[model samples]
Target chain A: MKTIQAVSYPVHFQDKAYKELSSLITKNGYSTIFILVDENTFEHCYPKFIPNLDSEKRIEVIEIESGEINKNIETCIGVWNAITELGGDRKSLLITLGGGVITDLGGFVASCFKRGIDFVNIPTTLLSMVDASVGGKTGVDLGVLKNQIGLFSNPEMVIVDVDFLTTVTEREIKSGMAEIIKYGVTYDIKLFKEIKKNKGLHINDLIFRSIEIKNEVVLQDPKEKNLRKILNFGHTIGHAIESFYLESEDKKNLTHGEAIAIGMVCESYISNKLLNFPETKLNEIKEVVLSIYDRINLLKEDFAGIMELLKHDKKNVNGQVNFVLLNDYENHKLDCKVTEDLIVDSMEFYNF
Target chain B: MKTIQAVSYPVHFQDKAYKELSSLITKNGYSTIFILVDENTFEHCYPKFIPNLDSEKRIEVIEIESGEINKNIETCIGVWNAITELGGDRKSLLITLGGGVITDLGGFVASCFKRGIDFVNIPTTLLSMVDASVGGKTGVDLGVLKNQIGLFSNPEMVIVDVDFLTTVTEREIKSGMAEIIKYGVTYDIKLFKEIKKNKGLHINDLIFRSIEIKNEVVLQDPKEKNLRKILNFGHTIGHAIESFYLESEDKKNLTHGEAIAIGMVCESYISNKLLNFPETKLNEIKEVVLSIYDRINLLKEDFAGIMELLKHDKKNVNGQVNFVLLNDYENHKLDCKVTEDLIVDSMEFYNF
Candidate 1:
């Protein structure tokens, strides 16, 4: 098992991660333990998860409904009230056991419960292991806006057990791959090439590389003031697209990775046009993303709606929509403002 | 104006505080400014507050109902939704201008909105100026529980203007004095003696002294691991009594200071019994508290409810209700456990 000391806590990898969790719980001497899981993880992951913990602490399970819709203030209130009613206190430990939604919502719940309590994350999904679990960013979507209510609170520990991934669907796996691809595009060209060559689903090396890149950026700028904005290369447009589809009555809910995949394609085109990014690399990015994620078609009508959503992006500062454009692999420009015409042109490139 | 650097920011005292606020706002360059106030502050204090702010920043005023009942999750949701709809973003600044309730809830809203934004506290009431604004503790009550959901995120600055306090009622002024008295009991003997000697209502020196003591304790232990628990000397029982009256059908709502004044008397009695606190000092404490806060009559039925509420105190560890008891002036014993029989005896002492 590999252990990476993150900005706030340690991220333990593989089967031995549970051992570390047990030790951490014992060391911290928590009064009680509460495990937060969604319906899917409660069924698919909790059975195996329970046996790994060897602590004699009184443990309680809080199960919320699965999916993004449940990750709101209502769910947080329910969870908080449950913990309070069940006698969970400042010394209680909340272990968030599931995907990004569970981790994000659970972390936010724990962070706010009695002015913050100690919590750990055992991320089940590939997206969470590489991204959500590493960053101390925990929050829930406000209305159609994603991550609009949250805090930068790290968990006591993060246990990344890939064994939980066996039950995850291929679509979910591919969804997580978008972020890995993003890390490669933004910080590591060799990593991009390495992932392209490796066809098998097993990519522990790739996930670790992504986390390392994120942690390095986060360490330099934890508050996303400057260097950390580079991490949002695809997320600004991706989150907007994600929110647009999420709210649309006719459209299917896009997985975070799927939406971000579309976002990467669109933003990469913008980077190519405005920042002299290689046409060949842009083509390569499109091919790789398209092979994994089905192309999301955006009509001229949809462009206005998506752009409207983009304006609400949390990354925007002082009414100016900022984008991180890449001129070359690992040579990224941060906080570059682009016009609406260029954004529409980028969407045209994605549609093509 | 006396300026004290707190754990994360500065606490600016008196008229010069607003100038500091203007400079801080100008220097930071926030996208927008949203001022959070209760009805009382809006009617009584904001007019005086507006003239002090010499900035051209676009400011919006969000007013909630004046009182503790409005400090809940429902109100937080309303405020958050309003901010989202109003196009408030990461760069926006939430300037909380009111008593404890406004500062507490507003600070909490700013902390969680968009995973945290910059906030400043311009405390109108004396209670907030001395205690609430300096601690970096932002939260709202849950059900009957006080400050059950919150975050330990400090504001960018705290501007304590005594000018706003001129409009406050005498009852409200006394409420703020409870915390000032608490600071003297727990940490500073000389300050306590000085307060007892001074008959005047003008307590600028006392307020400054109370904040300095709190800031010193908070700096030593930011997370309340050990030393900071001393700050909760009166708060444990105080919060329960406050919650009890707030929820009681027949009882009138007690101000935070009123509730805590009663708590200090009971806990001080417990200290005398358990830790050999000086009998003369205990009498002095009782006399001073009773003179300021009207004696709250707790019937036999109320004891069971108050004790039940006491068990749920966030200061508890492994189900043991812990407290900070003083045996001598400035000599505090933290995490001391008392039996139910002794707690009842302490209440009996107050009843006597």
Candidate 2:
């Protein structure tokens, strides 16, 4: 048992948490174990990772489509039926080993079986391990809408093994960085400065730091009532931008974090513009965000379409768009009322 | 505000709760409050029921195709996007005014809005108020499977107005009774005896009794860990039968409780063979179940299809078909397992 105090969950981190998890599983004497992975993770990874576990614990593998398109009622049924067909019961444990899609959908299936059973998570991607793994948000997408269906459920235990990132591509690596950067922008100015200064820093150490930042934010408010909304900082437009790109066949998706990366820049600039911060700091922010994220090109017309999509964004309360603005960065969240005009201006500035 | 203390979530069910709900929405407050009604309930009822609420609430009535076919992800997205275009948000509350489908889909949409807001359930049909209302098993169907994708979360409040049943058809009324009968067969012997005697039972009293049974089961295991599986008594095969007929263009679905009604009869026979259930008591159950549910004609070959569909039922763990067999009519529960052969025989016997 990897203990998470004042918590309903357990997680394994650093270099030692894996051995602790192995012994803990042995101590509990799990009759059998199953692993849920996506097609990408199963093919590229797992073969090398399998030998680390004891052969006596029965291991079965199940795979699904690796992206948001497959995250639906069809996939959930496929998983539930597959697990049950495989002889899964309350005693059977699930080991989710993939990115956000795998962990989110796996946790959801485990939560609903005969009411529910227990499942363990081994987030292979940095975005999942650092952000989605801790919050207990498990669900599927609702058509074009992202995470339009899900619940707050903590995993039984989490194994944040950096070894899984071996298969993650360069694009995926940057997507994960989007969220790591958000933590610095949202909560810790020191962490922000460090990330800014990480010219020669190993990405692995930054991954650990990112996970710690997420863990701290989630523990303070597990359910996301007040302090938690701060996490939505870039999501208002970030999500809208993602959905907009997702609709265009020729356009590329901004990974969960990358979209939020743009959201952070735009929202941060809004903070400066609306709150009248020093113009030099705004220029510093532009340089900082652009340095991390390559130039994103969107036409002025495209920005108008993005604003139209924003009307459908879920963050709106009674039809007005709500933005989680920052106060000099560290204070994290100041809910700002955003109009279409300001949003358009931010989009132009983002690409410029 | 409603004081409902079943087992886990204790709330004082009174006018005060409604008042608090009403006070919270003083403005035209919503773009429009939508009350989902079915064909059966709209013509037979709901006209007179609208007067009880504040006339200023700007309630809009939307009706959809009733029965299991409507509970699809396609329909969910339609309803969701429709609500969004109608200006729904964190402030708008979806009032599911009918049976399980309305509440289930409506709750799903509300829960997904900006990562969930609030939705109250006013269960018009008898089956919903007692069963579907209490347990937060909300989701839609995927292709031919049932509840293929969804989440578990309680409604903001549940309004159990027994008077709503006046609009229910005799067959619809009987369908809800199938579950009420189940509450007795699985947990309470006296409640079982009460149904056996066929005494002067008022609608209000029956609803209360059913709610009490659900409350007991839910309170002890709100998240459905151990004790909650008892509720799936007939649901294992029941859902299979319902899904089979539901998918067939030539067939009509048995109402949810009705499908489980047949499911109960067959699963009970399995309990008799696998769990050493007394034949005399099983006959008593058959007698009561048949009285409450209209007999349906099913082909002998349908058992093969039904059992095959049971493979997809979320209730099963690891492909091994797990049955919630009766330990004796009063305590149906976990630790119950039946061979696939026994499950086949039980389905065949119910048909012949």
Q: Write candidate 2's Cα lDDT for A3-61 as tens digits.
A: 34325666676456657667767876665687898878888767755766654777889
lDDT of 2 by residue, B167-199 (tens): 777777777887888888888877778877864
Question: In model 1, how large is the Cα lDDT of residue B281?
Answer: 95
For model 1, what is the alpha-carbon lDDT of residue A51? 91
iRMS of candidate 1, Å: 1.1
Model 1, docking class: high
Residue A271 in candidate 2 has what lDDT? Answer: 77
For candidate 2, what is the TM-score? 0.84
Mark the 10 consecutive residues where model 1 chain B has the least summed lDDT: B193-202
* RMSD value for candidate 2: 4.3
Candidate 1 per-residue lDDT, tens place, B1-352, comes to 5799999899998777878888988998887899998888898898988988889988888889988888998999999988877779888999999998999999999999988899999888889888897878999988878889998889999987787889899999989888888888998877777778775835778778888999999999998888888878888888888888888989988998998888898899999988999999999999888777778778888888889999888788778999899988789898888999988888788877
